[model samples]
Target chain A: DVKVTQSSRYLVKRTGEKVFLECVQDMDHENMFWYRQDPGLGLRLIYFSYDVKMKEKGDIPEGYSVSREKKERFSLILESASTNQTSMYLCASSLSYGNTIYFGEGSWLTVV
Target chain B: AQSVTQLDSHVSVSEGTPVLLRCNYSSSYSPSLFWYVQHPNKGLQLLLKYTSAATLVKGINGFEAEFKKSETSFHLTKPSAHMSDAAEYFCVVSTTGGGNKLTFGTGTQLKVEL
Candidate 1:
């Protein structure tokens, strides 16, 4: 079974704080993604990386950045957290550009 | 750009009854479709996928979906509904462009009544 793990399951941060959410996939998938889920909006993609050091913006990438320094690790960075940024963050990885995706349990971030 | 529309924002059904969730999509290419379920406070789980191989696709939890090109719809159905089946179901579509990026619907919340 493929397992994707996020560093934090629950986090709380204050406004204007820099927040980092880390994800690691055991399957060594080549494609990784970051998405923030909100009520009524569903899951909106934030950023995705097809390979190490390569990143692409998703539909809702504003105020968010991502890093893929290694194959197994992907990081989502919040430049400066805001109250509106509070939401459930999900990380997913796929073996290829278009394939079955395995998702991490998700990190719930709260910005105060 | 490709997009998906889940016709219902919420569907309520009794246990042991059939479950139906409607989804429609528009894509420039043949397109791949998927149904994902998310329990409260849990991650999304892929219930099934349609890769153009067959029009009728069977998925986990006794659920299935049919792809109708004429209607441009992929609706998810199940023979029986259980209490555990209550969750948010999302209809996803993948187009050929943009490196197979996926587009998700607004999502339908399924409520199973006793």
Candidate 2:
């Protein structure tokens, strides 16, 4: 079975604090993605990386950035967390385009 | 460009009753469709996918969805609702040109009653 592991299940951070949400996939997937999920609005992609050191902005990339220094690991960085940024962050990876994208358990971040 | 729309925000069904969750999509290129289920406080799980192979696609946990090109719809259904079936369902769409990017619907919350 493929497993996508998220480092943090939950976290509380003060406004203006930097936040890091880490994800690691056991499967050697070439594509990794970070998405923000909220009520009413569905999962909006924040960023995605098809290769190490290469990233692309998604529909809702504002207020967020991502790092993929290694192939199996991807990290979402919040430069300055804010109250509006409080939401569930999900990490996903796929073998390639048009394939099943497996997802992590998700990290719930609360900004106060 | 591709987009998905889930028709119902919420659907209530009693155990042993039929279940239906409607979805419609539009894509500039040939599209691939998927239905994902998210349980409470859990990650999204792929229930089924339609990649132009077959019109009727069967998925895990007795769930299935049919693809109708004439209607541009992919509706998920099950013969009987189970208590464990209560979850949020999302309809997603992607195209060959999208390059691994998926467009998601707002989602439908399914409530199963006794």
Candidate 3:
């Protein structure tokens, strides 16, 4: 079965600290995405990578950056983590630009 | 721009009863609609999608949704509710053309009682 694995299931970081969330997909999909899920807000896209070294900003891309140095891995970086950024982060990948997407288990981050 | 709205914030039902989760969307053109289920502390799973091919779409776990153009709604329904069916449901919409970025609704929490 296709699988997407996240580096961390739960994380806690101090305010103003830089944080990194990693995701790896086994499907070798061309499109990967990062979204933050919050209570009542549903899921909001943060950043997405179409290919290695290619990235696009989603609706909620702010104070965040992404890296896609390899085909299987995508990383989301928070330049300075804040309390407001605490939420569940999800990673998804699709075989093509527009197709069925698979999601990872998600990483829950708490910034104090 | 495209957007989705889940009319109900919460729905309570007894086991073996029917379930209905309301959703409405707005888009300049035709849109690709989807329903997702998120169990507690788990990732969101795709329940079903409507790509304008068919008005009625069936998803996993015996859940189905009908897309109505005149009403601009894609409401999820199930004939019978199970104890395990309690979870959060989200209505999402993506533009047909342009990019495939999805816009999600706030989501509705379903509670199943005995």
Candidate 4:
């Protein structure tokens, strides 16, 4: 079975603090994504990387950035966390277009 | 561009009763549709997907969905409701032009009672 591991299952940070959420996929998938999920908004993509060192902004990318220094690892960065940024962050990966995207267990981040 | 709509925000069913979740979609090109289930505090699980192969697609946990091009709908269904089936279900759509990016519906919360 494919495993998408998220480094943190829960985190609490003060406003203005820098936050990092890490994800690693064991399947060697080429496409990796970061999505923010909220109560009524479902899942909105924040950023995605199709290759190492390459990144693309998604629908909701204003408060987030991403890094893919290695093929299996994709990281989401919050330069300065805010109360509005408190939500569940999900990491997903897929082989390519038209393939099933597998998701991680998700990291719940709370900004106070 | 592609988009998805889940008609009902919530659906309730008694155990052993049938389950149905309605979904509609619009796209500029032929689309790939998927149904995903998210259990409480858990990750999203792919229940099924439609990729133009067959109109009817069967998935894990006795769940299935049918693709109707004429109606532009992909509705999920099951023969009987199980207490364990209670969760939030999302309808997602993607197109060739859209690459791997997907548009998701707001989601429908399923509630199963005795």
Query: Which 10-residue window in model 2 chain A sums to the lowest lDDT?
Result: A96-105
Model 2 over residues B1-114: C-alpha lDDT tens digits?
888999999999999999999999999888999999999999999999999898999999999999999999999999999999999999999898886799999999999999
Q: Chain A structural similarity (TM-score) per candidate?
A: 0.98, 0.99, 0.97, 0.99
lDDT of 1 by residue, A1-112 (tens): 9999998999999999999999999997999999889989988999999999999899999899999999999999999999999999999998884578888989999999
Error of 3 at A78 (Å): 0.7
- Model-by-model DockQ, in order: 0.70, 0.82, 0.65, 0.83
Candidate 4 overall lDDT versus native = 0.95
Q: Tell me the tens digit of each residue's lDDT in model 1 across B1-114.
A: 799999999999999999999999999888989999999888999999998898999999999999999999999999999999999999999877856578889999999999
Better model by TM-score: candidate 1 vs candidate 2: 2
Q: Please, what is the TM-score per model?
A: 0.98, 0.99, 0.96, 0.99
In candidate 4 the C-alpha lDDT for residue A44 amounts to 93
- Candidate 1: stretches off by over 4 Å: none
Q: What is the CA-based DockQ of model 3?
A: 0.65
> Which digits, one per residue and each the tens of the lDDT, describe model 4 over residues A37-66?
999889999999999999999999998889
> Which docking class does model 2 fall in?
high
